[model samples]
Target chain A: MSASPNQATDSDRSEVTAGIAAVLHPAARGAAREVPDAPPRGRTAWSLLGLSGIGFGLLAVSIVVSVRIGTSGVSYGDLGRSLGSRLGVAEPLPRLLDSLIWDLRVPRVLMAAVVGALLAVCGAVLQAVTRNALADPYLLGVSHGASTGAVLVVVLAIGAGSLGVTGGAFVGALVSFGLLMLLLRRSGLDSVRVVLTGVVVGQLFAAVTSLVLMASGDADATRAITYWLLGSMASARWGVVIVCAIVAALGLAVVWWYSAALDAFSFGADTAASLGINVRRTRIMLLVVTALLTSVAVASVGAIGFVGLIVPHGVRFLVGPLHRALLPFAALAGAVFLVWTDALARVSFAPQEVPVGVFTALIGVPLFLFVLRRRGEL
Target chain B: MRITVEDLSWAVSGTGILCDIDANVTSGETVGLIGPNGSGKSSLLRCIAGLRAPTSGAIRYETSDIHGWSARQIAQYVAFVEQALDSDSDLRVADVVALGRTPFRDRWRGLSHTDRAIIDAALAQVGLADLRSRGWKTLSGGERQRAHIARALAQQPWGIVLDEPTNHLDVRHQLELMRLLTDTDQTVLIALHDLSLAARFCDRLLLLHRGTLVATGPPEDVLTPDRLRDVFEVDAEIGQDSLGHLTVAYRGTA
Candidate 1:
């Protein structure tokens, strides 16, 4: 490298000048016109759709198989007949068997799928929105907030049953989200602040939950709350399943619509804004949506763990990081994953019936490490 | 597009970064913004690019006030490249370039045929057509700068603003990037720390001292030795190189 411009000869400078001129000449300007019709990059739209079709097929199969795997000895034929009869296409089963399948098993399987999908998509969105790989629904404090609300309701004997707990959880989740926004009001919602503030709020709520539970002095209620905290699909009913399904679908749609904006955020907020994203508005909307979805899920299932955190990382590894493909694929992969995990929890210990959250971590940790290793980030 | 900055001023926390600045770059002209550190060069460029709102006055692109436009609408006409921008995500070069078309497409649509063609053209223009599939992490500093420039080209913007784009480049790459910018027909407003490069490559120079525009004219007039001492706090000689280009030779700090 030449440190002194004074050493340059006129010929050397002229050569550089001529080189630039040749590169910028009108004939060379056609360099762009001569672009060799290169093949498209990454997966084509049809291939992506085909892959999504496979994922959906796998989820459907998982749900049906999951509904059949229990101590009741329900056969595949019985499962089909039950579904067909509900759809009015086949003969109805006996009263007890129909109630068992329709009112319990089917809704429980569907609820697990819905909850899993919701958590996974929320995780992926939060990870991108916050630029933090470790972000998940639990990290947002919404789950702990819900637990605190449900704990308070239970200890006080509000007496509206599960509905009262659900209502309390939703309100608690909202309060935590409100606090997060208030704390971030002057901070511009940057990634570090968002993640640290979320952790702080979650810790606060967790402490409150523990304090209320210890102060109540009711062993039975504490045991019940403890089981709920570990999360289960045992209480899954058609009403809650339907409500969760609707919210998850709408929320996923909202997040997916901002897929391009998420891509822009890869270079940080200033670049994202320069690329035409309304940075503040987009971040707020995404945060609110993710928090709401997590609230609805936590209220019903009592904070199922690992699915949101691990599923998105796994999906990103599989399909790359473009959120349009990443979000849907994550939803499908998560739904299938949870349906099977819930089934394993139900039958693994048989009469003991271990919590699904326990199985998720047991399975999720190794899978996450595998993904990290494959991505060369381990 | 011609950019007009009329009585523009900006402040942060009640301290003004740019004060009562006024300048204009006619369509297809290359203007260099030269100033020492903290002299409001980047601030003025950001205001013209519509990234920051001015505390007073206005920036107009041709006939329209850009402050009244959406970010998308502003992006369609003027592309901005900051001094340092990088990403940690697993985005390919082509994926980053495709981001340039964001303002044209809506949420319901994917890249159109025309969008692909334009992306190809942009890559070719920046000599990165073959490196389109390369991961961002794999690129060297100069290649990354070219890729960023390619992204700006993909926007098909009529005017481009860059702030100290050659900061980390080697001498050869710095010269090449300057040549590339000068060759482009788009109106260019760039901030440069290298007085010699700015003098040779840019059509006109806008010189700043503190928050005010101290000089604006051809390089020979703006790079006078006395102004260099007063504004840059350096004793320097303005001379012509063997190639008959204006050259600023710094003697020492004042």
Candidate 2:
């Protein structure tokens, strides 16, 4: 029927309304189809879990081994005795070696692991939210912002009375993130725009940092700024380690909670929205969480480059692209990687410790290139 | 489910995209949304699916206004598939289909036995059971489209809304997809560029012309030569095939 103006009247309405009653039921057509003889859980889950277990094992070994291999070179027996005494399971070692392992190396190594885990998780989440493979906290200007805040304190002595480098870095990271959020809110958080904004903001802050250091003309202040800029766990204390550990754990828990939604995002925003995800709210929440994680890591030990950028990609190659597996695996891999890299930095140049960031870039650039080449992902 | 659109209009920055569109898709009816490019067919589908809000109209799913429902609530009844899904993800095909179960799944819970059965059935229905473990990037264009259909099927929704589902499909797959949609008991609202397929498969057609509803009725009523020439700007001869399906023969652009 043509559904002319007259025919669209009340008589046809009754017939159309009659059809509504049977409409809302689920289709019964596919229920009787023979399901293939596949395992319900599949091998992928078990394999990923096994790989994650291996990653954690490597992290533990890295921490224990790296703790012993530092410049002081405590023997394995002394290391065991030192750990045993700390746990109150055995007789204590001599005062010097005990303090060296329990006091210095243990916390430093632990901080490296925490920072690595934080940065890597942050990178993974950011990459998912922005839908950019290359996204990382450092590349997005979050780390540079923390550097600006830390440098502002060290050079200008703005927070000399109360806020130290860590406090300054935290505030700087938030402020920079606040600016990024503002820009995103205004311009609608497109992936390319976010990366472009981060790059521009990072360069602007870097220039200001340079100008301040050049104008101050103070060698000691410049040295301190340079060391912090290149990132180090040299100043790692028990307090910083504890705080970072808490932040990293909390951040990981939150990211894990949204891991399913994050997987939806890999399909793009429109598809994510169709999957009943509140795309805008989820993106904002994940971005803020990532910024907070990046800030905590940077504030505690400056900005360690490439862990965030490279760890997720490396882990993705191992576990595929599911965020549920990628996030945790990346965290474990990052922890193990940074612990060894910090150890190498300590011994690579002997008396003068090279910045861990330098080693990270040196190793990370090559590894990243290799991964890209292997995946054929430009 | 029955979808009743009452004076639905969508505008962007004061520019109209869909203007005063009114239509009714009855229960289990496969309604084709036919329009040329930029004529607002996709926008109307988005609004109906609750992915976009209409500027000043109401879309009722059954007796409830979908505008006031949460995205999850709306998704429980209506599933929308986009024309082309562009993703760089390396997820396996099974994982991609598992995303359809998201609206039913809790944040902490993994797929249950029932969910797995439904997902498997959907994959089988789409002829992708053998390729469930294949990487998403490895699938051909037609396979990708079928995978998306399988995803919608996994949702177990009461109604399925699709935007240009046949855009990338070859002729065989395109016909297969339309056949599948017509065979389903679920109410379907699909936007299509291929008029002959729409004429053959759709029970009813809503013809949109430059952001307005130009015509609405059964295929034979809506696919007339005058209506095709007016809305699609094409001269077409229409006839009934041996199976009583309406066939359109396009001569040239008007």
Candidate 3:
């Protein structure tokens, strides 16, 4: 079989050589000189800026529309008045409507956007670092680790009185990420090994979470654990929203700063290193940032799936794969996507809210399939 | 810049890939590295490019030891082109070539006008100026090879190290690429399998066998029939063509 292929290539080589020789001949020079004109310079930059502007515009619209959606019959006018009153620019809204928007709806919508942006950026960075399109925060099992900690607090009441489920989840995420780093260090930080180790470690943490929940005899605690696992923004508070938003912003900044290096990585680690990038240091740093962002997000709102897996892929189709353009657009599109998903979670069934994670998967699975089909990968 | 490899050796796992390899590449010289497959040509190039650290000995660029220099610092003076160029991105040809400026530009800054000019000149040199906007995935195999050469040219380095750069090119492109390298004043160390092309274009040839330097000299001295049989396992007749270019005709495996 190898000999036949070699014979075929030998024949092909002669034909190709003849063709190339013809191209190099003086008679063909004029024709070759008449080649296609260069594409207009700065076109990519203009398109990226234009697309980013559209993304931000869509995000603004999504926020406004999502905030107006709920069980209450509060009008946009009332929500505006409430926001204006808080900013000291208008008359105070009716006490009921003001507290409803100020204390509950606004923070929930903001947290949803922040978490979405964080997950999407993490997904982009992880995909670049690992050179695997399937990579995401969940791929590393940080969410499962966070779930284990949350379950321990919610079901077993371990640390519930002090650190609480949120605090416990954060710690769990850090521990899992730390363990992953240690294992990867020993395994030479190959992407495949990192992914495989994550799967094993993630499964172990998830089993522990289930074991804790099963051991708890309290039916109420079991129900709470199940609800949290499916994920929701219903428990979002101002403090959680503020902390998550800050962390997400910082993560975005760090990822954006490394966008060029990320573009080099799309070729592969060796190629990136050949381009003078410090591949080992850059990969480790990106892993740390993505893990941190994922931990903070999962801690705030249970393990929300799909946003991290699908958002970067979706954004890449629209703006191509350069990270400088992909990162910002992914963040904006992700923010808008989750805000609407959270809105659907609130109103899809009316009164009895479904977990926002369910809605994201409902939307994400079809979108992912569509993208794969379009790319001809499926 | 002159690159001096003094008693250099590299090992992978427990086995040596390169052993006590000594060679000197003076500025403005084109040196051909010729050997059978697995003779450590690529490994030697990687070490010189600072993509790999030698297990022992030293590589010096002019007066400075390259091992102590950062990858970025080394890249500013030396550009490397590996045999394989695989990119999963949809970046355009110009964008790929502009990546050569990575060592010079700030991480956050866009390419300046001078960078753009250098990229255009490099593209023109490789006759790919027309394809600057073409997607990298859309290029033919020969065109892709030229684009990579263009990228190395855009680096504007004092020295270049290429591993099997002509592997996929047609005969015309292979000759043209060698001519381009010979025309330049920069120091070059190119790994090649085509002995005739090496003999024609290189100022010096370094032959390796089993991780050791077997010969290093002008083509006439390095391409002797005895050495070819012993190192490459090929029985061949060597002579000069009408244009005074050295030619090799192989009869059979040794």
Candidate 4:
């Protein structure tokens, strides 16, 4: 039963798996997991749902705690005024409530949540797009680059004021992103290469920052740079909080819209292309959005570490690689995580606040270790 | 749909892969291409599917050159299942099959009911209707392969391309998968290492050696002892099965 070339099929494909049965060798000598029907599907779904629910629950708790934080203080009328208004309690049981709700507590909570969600969402998308578990926004040197720019404005008086620091940080982020593209084009944007390059660049900028600090004669400027390096939400006025939230929301929307493309990417570049995805274009878009999210978040929070690297990995164990599911869960989890971390930072030493980034790093490293051990990847 | 490959040559990383080759395949027909390792079998297949561009040839589908065609455009006529056994995440069997319809989907639209129905039919065709809801990563190797084949089938392409789809399947599934294609409307292009299997089922054969076309004819003409020794460097016994189909048995080295 043969036909001429003219009668052959249009596909003209080769390597047909015509006749080979891989016997399920119950004892294939060294088989890790049997290939058929090994892992439970329902359990994964159930766990993802449960974890998301808990995430929301955590967000609620965080919001409540953030509102209550300034209630105990005597100097702050903000919390008490807001609490009195909320409870319909008699008159002014201390006006700490109004100040807390309007100026410090509420705005700080929102900024932390916005930064955390931005980081976590970007992290989740990055990991999926690059097909690596360790991908994060800061893997491109944006964080350190921003830091160098902000440090210059603070310690070297290059900007000579607060406004210049933010603008310089934004410009620094753009320049580093461009440098990353130029230096790493040949290898095809590998996740490991990008992250390692970022680390190297980060050290270079760290040296620059050190040089500036050592040369500075102003103690107050040096202290400001030091505090900023540590990262905090203490400076989140309502205006800054609004900007952070807007950026995070817009960035998250872009990521959410491209979730389908992200899902396709996990299968490999060739497969995704065969499915009609413009892989290169989509990747470029993802990189841009994540960078925007990173710059805005870093600018607001002054380089809070660990949230971006750690939250998405924790969420992935529960959710798998579907970006639509992974992203929302990661966002909620991140907000909750940063909220609690920020709260702990504020309350740990009481009047003397710890830098939230320090607390996040200290707690994040162990959790990260535990997750790695659980995954057997260590 | 009909495809014509005219004087095709392919180069990769400055190395020649496929040199001066030509072939044709029609819609709703079953054909086979047989070759040894590194004979550019996969590369040729990729070029046909528009997944890769040939250095000096045009693969035309339905009279349209696939040279500059997007993967999505070519996908409408051809669905390719690669040789690798792979599954990511805990996606269900049905979900994997439905992914084949991605190219057919409007940019922002969700899966249509027709898409789901086609996926269901594909699952049924592969004898996995009962397992449609099963998670992909949990399936047996054979089952996973079937699931991918089903996915290609769901795309409703004019022909389906299989790249060593039977590498991991045992004899039973091997027969089942081959048999599954017998009555289908979609044409089949399969690359096989086993000459006997190719002889028993393939309607036509296109044989390659050293990235060049060595022979093209009936299994009887193509699977001869002389050609086997010349191209594959193996001595083999060729005969007829009780079903009057060509059958081959490898004897030894050339």
Per-candidate TM equals 0.92, 0.93, 0.90, 0.82
Superposition error at A195 for model 3 (Å): 2.2
lDDT of 2 at A207: 84
After superposition, the stretches of candidate 3 with alpha carbons farther than 4 Å from their true spots are: A1-40, A160-163, A217-219, B240-243
Residue-level lDDT of model 2, residues A1-378, one tens digit each, is 112112122334334323422221245344434664345576757777788778878888898889887777888888889878879998999898788888889899999999999998999998888888888877668777887888789877876632399999998889988888887788777678878988888887788788888888889889988888889998888988998899889999999989889998877877788888888788778888888888888888888889999999998888888887888888998998899899999998888899999999999999999888877786
Note the DockQ of each predicted structure: 0.23, 0.33, 0.15, 0.14
- Compared with the true structure, what per-residue lDDT tens digits does model 2 show for residues B98-120? 88888777677677666677677
Least accurate 10 contiguous residues by lDDT in model 4 chain B: B107-116
Model 2, backbone clash pairs (residues 3+ apart or across chains), number:
0
- Which regions of candidate 1 deviate over 4 angstroms? A1-29, A36-43
Reference A-B contact fraction recovered by candidate 4: 0.20
Tens digits of lDDT, candidate 4, B46-91:
8887788889978877666766666666665678888865744556
> What lDDT score goes with residue A48 in model 2?
76
> For each model in turn, which proportion of the native inter-chain contacts is also found?
0.41, 0.39, 0.27, 0.20
lDDT of 1 by residue, B122-200 (tens): 7887888889988888898988888888888777666889999999999998998888777778788999999999999
DockQ of 2: 0.33
Give the C-alpha interface root-mean-square deviation per candidate.
13.2, 9.1, 14.9, 11.0
For residues A291-369, write the lDDT of model 1, one tens digit per residue.
Answer: 9999999999888999999999998877878888899999999899999999999999998899999999999999999
lDDT of 1 at A316: 80
